[model samples]
Target: MSLLDVHRSIVVIIDLQGKLMDMIYRPNLVISSTIRLMKLADLFEVPVVITEQYPKGLGSTHPQVLSVYEKLTTKKFYMEKDSFGCCEDQFYSILKNARPDTNKQQIIIAGIEAHVCVMQTVIELQENGYEAHVCWECVSGRGEEYRDHALQRMNQKGAIITNHESVGFEWARDKNHPKFKEMSRLFREGQITS
Candidate 1:
């Protein structure tokens, strides 16, 4: 796959909701990485689509992500769904309504339960002909094994497994890009060093 072009990409934040989020392994890392991804999306004018899986039961999205999203003035797409895979009719309609431009075919994914929702979404994204790139640090499952296996499965199924920093740099493309400095700052600060 080619480096992500900011103008040709979209970030999809999936099912990072309440209690389920709390149970995910290293939830803090996931949250911080996802926040950085959101900021990068905002900086590059990349559209973001956030989904909640039955929020009435799982509760709402984690406040940190919600806060960053709320502050963005760019066109945003938010949907609440019961489907584990976000490729449902409703999501398709929202994506369509967003008027997904021809170049905006690359989808960057981040969220919880990598073995399920994230994996399913990535598979479906590929089926729909969109290149899927999963931000490794931004997705987690309740168990390390689950997360690893999910990523392996995704890679086997044609999804590119990558990190947030790689995605940001790929989007920026060069130091000469207007937002490179801020993107670099975000890359440094957003990393979780054990």
Candidate 2:
């Protein structure tokens, strides 16, 4: 129920690896939404944490996504892990090091395999007292049904189920905000429909 405060938030794009991304349902939609979300985060100066679940096996985070991050602030925190839930020790360490202020705990989660990695990450993030906002449009599973069930399950478990556009506008708060023009441009390029 509340809008995401950029000062209290961080963007977490998880496990959007190579082959897996191509297999996910609606891969183009998910990737486009995620790219826009990351762009919004960059515009707002929110810390971005990207993870790959065994990249050696799954391949690196999709090249297109990587290219976007590369253009943004060089402050990208990249983590590689075997764990499904990104709430691991290394993740905590990187996050802590990224922001250092304990109060910045709102997590905007976007990525693939909604029913598995995304689901587990949201659950553990909520359990750890972090406000986990799941970007519905930016998440997908191997099947549409699984992604739908995952979103329902995460919502039931207290993660705020939202889309990338909602998150972007909520964080921007007002059109007069300094980054508004840039944010608007990104959304337009994304061709996100109401």
Candidate 3:
């Protein structure tokens, strides 16, 4: 929809743990895009939620991501989940509490291991009436084939697949907007490079 519509969207970063992130290809790309998404969300005042899948075993979220969260004045809900699909009771409860007032019932998602955690979460989010949009460049798996298949399946289930920059511009809408300069600067400086 329009940038105003996407402005009401919530950003959910799932299971981007330190150990798990190390196993994925192009981890830097994922981390950079995710952090940029977080920063943009902050600028727009959109809510953000992060989840760690079995963090006790996989380890906490990467230091870079954790550092960003620490600086946010917006309350970020961080959950430790054993379930692959983060749309379970706990996360659903968080969603219920943080539900946007606008009609944009959307979830902008990014994370690690696309084939499992990200895939299952997006599927469940769609099933639960949320428009789940997955940022492709911000997600990855241990293998390219698995990541490809997961994206294909998510597309089949109606998850909008896109890249980080597109999502930013879609949300920003016009160059004349107040945040346009900052977003453009971020893009030009390669802060959100994929």
Candidate 4:
């Protein structure tokens, strides 16, 4: 309902695991967009939550995505889970509790298998009273129809159907924020033309 406050937002990158990554439609777009979103998170100093779904079977989060989190000192949380919806994972407590200083409520979502894991997670995040902003380009299914319908369903359920650029601009807010210059620079670099 409001702009994404840097203090109240968290980037949640879900289940971009190895074996499933290539199976998704527009895998490269999903990866690149998600990576750019992560960079925006770092620039804005927003926290990020990265989840790996049954890494033993899904084959772990992709090395490039995982490496971004590893290299950044930006606030982050990591969890490995068997649950399709991250909210169902026993290890995940509360999204707002991710940091002691802020009660984060908007979840910027990115990840794979949009029809299954991503869809379930977005719906549940809504049920739990969090704003689930699905970055369209950062999510994919093995088929385009599945991904599109999943997004449609989630939008119908009141999830904010968004993209990485919208999220970045919303977070940056205005040209006056301390990180606005860097935020613009990130998006300017090889950004996909919408």
Each model's lDDT comes to: 0.87, 0.86, 0.82, 0.85
Model 1: weakest 10-residue lDDT segment is 95-104
Query: What digit string (tens of lDDT, one per residue) describes model 1 on residues 20-127?
Result: 987998888899888888888888888899999999889999998999999976678999888899999988777666545654488899998899999999999898
Residue range 1-194, candidate 4, lDDT tens digits: 67777788889999999999878898888888988999988887888899888988779888989888887678888888887878864424646456566554888999988999899999988887788899999999899999999999999999998988898889877889888888778877885632
Could you give candidate 3's per-residue lDDT for residues 1-194 as a string of tens digits? 23325545888998889788878877888899888888877766667899998888999989998899778766477888988889778897787666645554678899978999999999988887788888988889897888889999999998999876777788778888788898887777655444
Q: Please, what are the lDDT tens digits per residue for candidate 2 over residues 64-110?
A: 88899888873579899898888899998887877786664888999
Error of 4 at 84 (Å): 0.9
TM-score of each: 0.94, 0.94, 0.92, 0.93
Candidate 1: list runs displaced more than 4 Å: 190-194
- Sorted by lDDT (best first), the order is 1, 2, 4, 3
Q: Distance (Å) between predicted and true CA of 172, model 4? A: 1.6
- Distance from true position, residue 104, model 2, in Å? 5.3
Report residue 170 deviation for candidate 1 (angstroms): 0.9
Q: What would you estimate as the lDDT of candidate 1?
A: 0.87
Q: Which portions of model 2 show Cα errors greater than 4 Å?
A: 190-194
**In model 1, what is the error at residue 109, expressed in angstroms?**
0.3
- List the candidate 3 regions with Cα displacement exceeding 4 Å: 1-4, 191-194
